[model samples]
Target: MAKKVLLRVYGMTCDDCVAHVKNGLEKIGKNVDVSLDGNAVLDIDNDFDPYKIPSLDVFNGRYKAQVKEIKDD
Candidate 1:
């Protein structure tokens, strides 16, 4: 079974910020699908947990993005 989720992120100030988050998620998910808005939706199969995945900032250790919300689809 696959899961879908919406992610609202803060610290995104422009298109590059959007791209940064999008790219980061894609890298983490590998084969999963990802799209970005003020938030992002991720569709995945398996035990991957969005909440457990470190924030973009945390992963990079630069504090560039913060997750604002996580919701099911």
Candidate 2:
């Protein structure tokens, strides 16, 4: 099973931030679409735990992520 999730991201100030967010999210999902406007959408495995969504520490704590929605896909 697969799930489509909408994420609300914060602290993205530029394109570089978007890239970082996209790359980080790709580790957990596919079809990653990240925007500087503070949103991202992706398809994740059903077994993927939403509670484990990273704090995006790859960017040195510059970003935060929260699940806004999730649905069967």
Task: Write down the TM-score for model 2.
Answer: 0.88
Candidate 1, 1-73: lDDT as tens digits: 3556555555555777666666777755544333334556666445776665555443464324334454444
| Model 2 poorest ten-residue lDDT run | 51-60
Model 1, global lDDT: 0.54
Q: List, residue by residue over 1-73, the lDDT tens digit for candidate 2.
A: 3888898888899998899889888888899999999989989898887656755455358788888988888
Report how far off residue 73 is in candidate 1 (Å): 7.7
Q: What is model 1's C-alpha RMSD? A: 4.0
Every model: Cα RMSD to truth: 4.0, 1.7
Quantify all predictions' global Cα lDDT against the true fold: 0.54, 0.83
